[model samples]
Target: MKSMTGYGRSSFLCENVEVSVEVSSVNKRNLETVVSLPRDWQALEREILTLTKEVVSRGRINFSVKARVDKAERPEASWDEKRLRDDLEQLRIFAEAEGIPYHPDASLLCRLASGQKFEQSLPDPTKMTEGLKQAAQEALKAMIQTRIEEGKHLEADIKARNAEITCLVNELEVSSEGISALWREKLLERLRQAELELDAEDERVLREVALFAERCDVSEELTRLRSHGELMNQILEEDGPVGRKLEFALQEISRELNTVASKSPSTEVKRLVIEARAECEKIREQALNVE
Candidate 1:
């Protein structure tokens, strides 16, 4: 079992650049991922998302990348001082030959100071892309480890609650005996209170009691509920994403319990059914965090 919520982080640093990746996830019915990276590295976002999909099949995942680079250390940022001076000298000679009054303003000097000052220094794009993917993958690996650890806790808690539900079911079953006779007696009492004359052993009364007993028979529901419980155990043992499947199975289990609750006339049985339903509700809630 694995949980859908977790967090991880990784940082990579070299002489000229330092980059870090952080990944966080939360419970969700489907896998949804969002990535934020340096604009220069935006092209690599797809590769990171692909890596995330490979590691996580369920959850709402959010990730971000932060980078710091020493611009002066890059070849691109180095000033072309020789080229700039050569161009300036040629322009000065042209002006002297044309006999024109030339003014070399600060703007031209600044422009010629560097080819592209705004563009920051960076490592090779291909290697940087691969590095980004690797960092994100490492963070994802940590996040998945955390999820697995949390999942072990969830599985144990759910299992204990399942046992509680089973106990309630058993209690309801044992308390359901003689329910038909009790309902028949109560029906006769109601008739007496209404001032109607009816023999307790009358053919009509016997037939009504038999019909009521058949209606209230929860044997099939009990059988199905137990079967569903066993199936739940089976699913927990298997691997892969089982949150949605477990959700559906719990719905079926709850449905069977509801049927049992409706058919039984005994207050004790109803009480037990309520407790069992509560346990099932807890299990359903926990399933939302599963993947």
Candidate 2:
């Protein structure tokens, strides 16, 4: 058992690039991965998605990769000498025409050229790709570890709930005989209150009541429920993804609980059935996070 909600991040440093990868996920019915990479690294997106699918069976997963080149490897800013010279020539001519004073000092020229000066550097695609792949693999491994830890917790909770439900089932069985006796006594009291006397009819009434008791019996449901619980435990203990299988099994358990609830006759039996159903619902909700 493993939870689908988790996040992990990793960073890789190559020759002149630092790459960071982050993976986050949430519960989903099917496997879906969305990757975000630099435009230059778009070709790697499909490969990354395929790798994720091989590792993570099911989830709404988001993978993000960010890369930055080392500052030392980046080009240094330099003055655009031609553009600055042209601008200064035009400025001097305009000053003379307008009869305004113009100081063509080194500081002024540098200030004027600042806007046009810029560094043009492109990151190495090969280095970035290698770093990104390493970061992504590390992040994926961390995410899977987190999910496995959470799965252990969920498995323990579901197991405890299954135990409680089984205990309740046993209690219901123990009280069933008492419930039948009470029903018979109640029926007799009602008949007596109605001033109905049927010496030959009493036997038939008892026989019908016994049959009704059998029809409303929950022994079969309890048996099946226990069996399902065992199977769920077995699946949880296995080595791979079992979310879909566990979910389907939980649905079956819910169906059985509903049947037991509907067939319940005595108030005590109804209450027990409701308790069992509540446990089943909890397990079902937990199953949604399994993987």
Highest-TM-score candidate: 1
Q: Which is the leading candidate under lDDT?
A: 1
User: Per-residue lDDT of 1-291 in model 1, one digit per residue for the tens?
Assistant: 898989999988744688889999999999999998765567888898899888789999999988766656655566657777897898899999999878898898887664334224555556687678788889999999999999998888888888788777777778888889888999899989999889999898899999999999998888888888888888888788888878988999899988988887777888888888888989998999999
Q: 206 in model 2: Cα distance from truth in Å?
A: 3.7
lDDT of 2 by residue, 176-233 (tens): 6566566777777777789986453578777967987887787888889888878977
For candidate 2, the lDDT comes to 0.79
TM for every model, in the order presented, reads 0.80, 0.78
Off by over 4 Å in 1: 70-119, 190-200
After superposition on all CA atoms, what RMSD does each candidate show versus the true structure?
11.2, 10.4
- What Cα-based lDDT does every candidate model obtain? 0.84, 0.79
Error of 1 at 246 (Å): 1.0
